[model samples]
Target chain A: MSGIYSERHTLEKTESASETANEPVKKGDTAEVKESVAVNKMRTEFAALAVNEAFARAAAAAFFSRLDPTVEELTEIKTAVSEAVSNAVIHGYQGGSADKTVVMECEYENSGIIKIAVSDCGVGIKDVEEARRPLFTTGDAEERSGMGFTVMESFMDRVAVESEEGKGTRVTLIKSLDISYYGV
Target chain B: MKTEFEITDNILIAKLSGEIDHHEAADIRSDIDGTYAAFKKKHIIMDFSGVSFVDSSGIGVIMGRYKKTAENGGITAICGCSEYLRSILYMAGIFTIVKEAKNKEDAVKLVKRLEAAESGEIFQEEKEAE
Candidate 1:
């Protein structure tokens, strides 16, 4: 699992949140915003293992922490990531194939918006709309509650899903940081 | 994930600690459900104060147990959840069937009432069965 993260540690820090450049720098001025946009992308090819469900969540949570989200917001993101990854592992790969990979990408804007995407190379959903409905699970064989998409939609600001049958699925989730938490 | 269980009378209280995700929920659901059956408990109280993190799968675990216990004429209550968890529970429609308590003691009292009601003591027939 650690191998997935180390594969791509492309950290691009963009100074998008600061107006320090607009301020005239006096001789004694030492104050600056000192913040930047953090972009990170990682991919993992595990055996559709159940333990990787937590791994996915942990990885996403760690990535989102760069934005300094509140505990509540962090929990919400973690839950959303867990649902997407769980769907990939259980429904996508059907619990393990010889060569399967789940790719996750996250971008944190200095303006406090976080975007996350989890993609898998496995059997994709036939109908994305029906899947998003509450309690609309296709994995009845595993006692799945069918609440994965519902949970993701509920926790994140927006959720988008794209899939092709016999191809794969990709889910995107977005959440803006609560302004009160950042005082921005 | 770590689970601690304490039984008094017919109520089984389970305290879940650590992060709860799909993986953890899978094991926790089995463990708690198994313990609930093994103890022959009439009600269940889940304490989430020790739990630091939870996702939708955690919601699934609690919902599954609530249904299982309810089917057997038992009650399930939750206590010690963070404010955010309470919000999630409400939005997920979990609050419709399962009630919330401020703490374990309060949950026990709530379950006592529910158990009494289930046994027909709160309504009538306290003496019919006795």
Candidate 2:
């Protein structure tokens, strides 16, 4: 079943989130007593366009949170990816081609960092510098947010976007997991 | 991924199991539209009981579906929302478009009443009196 709707996600291995490491096992301790909490993880893809952006972001957020990302950390990752995926949809698929689909892969890194990679196969970005600029879009009718890359920079610790005009675009973002908020 | 939809009385409930993201949205949209079309139910309730994480993209799915339901003169409600999900929903203004209930039972009741009013099963004057 989809993890999107429930928090009681079952897993293969069990280890509690560091947050649970603090409290003593007092008699009245009624906190979630599960021996270990597993990081929730999800991986999926979407066809390029406005339609798929939201779903991609939501699923990625859920999956990444399992690594114990802070609220701020997660938000930054979401914004960066949202722009990249949106670009893929608007710039890649919207160009009117038969093959459509943007690939997304996310991994939780060992140092509590979440790594997200988004790649597309449609028309590539010819001028990487211009595309990265705030409020710059090749499209006319669909009022571009132009702030796509800007939002990404604001939210993520690292964002590397590589593109070629005729090829495709790949954007990667990484952020460290902040466990202190959870008192881990 | 497996998705389930059912109608109990006048309420339409959809349970989405699996990850909900862009890649899965079209299928989800099709599933939801097909379910609503088949039941012809007036009130729509989505059980987020199984959803673990959601982003703006997921918000688009809910908003898009809500528009479709609203076009049919029906209302949409949500239930079993996690606090994490609720924060995103609130920021996206989902509460402005549809009502949310505490659980599936509460949702069914709310939608049924809306259906009753639409179908004239509940006397308008009597409903006002109560």
Candidate 3:
């Protein structure tokens, strides 16, 4: 879980607002498209680990590539986002190789929302509610702060954890880029 | 990440530097435990002199080290904590068992005295030979 999202807010308190209905993948052009910077990035799945650095780098490249994020807010978003990715890898995989891949998708929805989906097809969670509890640990040897979700919630505007006991887990996060909290 | 170990008068000093979060805890635990197992020291001093920022994951690492020391009948002391990092340490209750020192010499002195008390020998000929 290691990326930076300074101008974003976490949505931990809200339930799953996942519409599940996939709108047609709209490719926006600068002249015709209402939204200026088109939102699209491709990330390869390799086990479960913090992919925020990759995502952040991509986002920074696509959106704020020319502008740099300040050190403090950069650290905040990087740490929290990385932690969220780490949680998906550790808890979602249950430390098994069988849980082969963790899928990550990053897209910009207009100028207001940046949506991220980190999904894993491993042993899904038994309790989504309890898992979000701070200081919770199910790892025998893995040292976790258990505040990954908390930090994610604190940092992002929307955090939705989708999991089924036998299936896997997917965390969808949305954040706003309108605020000046993030460096240009 | 650098880990150094040395035994002086039955006290093992494990110096750890750099950022150690959840990702590195497992391997560090194994290395420290393996070193202590070989030496069987009565006291352990973990010098946190060069650490910058430590998060809650660091708390787990400290707790694991504390457990290891207690189980081996040795006390764990953490020294060289800066004023800036004291809050994180305090929040994690690391001060409860992990003792701090002004410097390395002071920590070594404390460990020597503890060792002397434990073995009940201020100067033993055989212990001094090896």
Best-matching candidate per lDDT: 1
Fraction of native contacts in model 3?
0.22
Error of 2 at B47 (Å): 0.8
Q: What TM-score, over all chains together, does every model reach?
A: 0.78, 0.54, 0.63
Cα lDDT of model 3 by residue, B87-128, tens digit: 455654568877777777678776665656777968343334
Q: Which has the better TM-score: candidate 1, or candidate 2? A: 1
The residue-by-residue lDDT of candidate 1 on B76-119, one tens digit each, is 89999998877767667888888899999878877777677766
lDDT of 2 by residue, B1-130 (tens): 5668877755678887655554465587788878888878766788888875444445666777787777888888888887766766665567998888888877877776666777889733223311
Q: Pick the candidate with the highest DockQ.
A: 1
Model 3, CA-based lDDT:
0.59
TM-score leader: 1
Which parts of model 1 have CA positions greater than 4 angstroms off? A1-47, A141-143, A178-184, B120-130
Q: Which residue pairs clash in candidate 1?
A: none
Q: Identify the superior model by TM-score, candidate 1 or candidate 3.
A: 1
lDDT accuracy of residue A92 in candidate 1: 90
DockQ scores of the candidates: 0.37, 0.06, 0.24
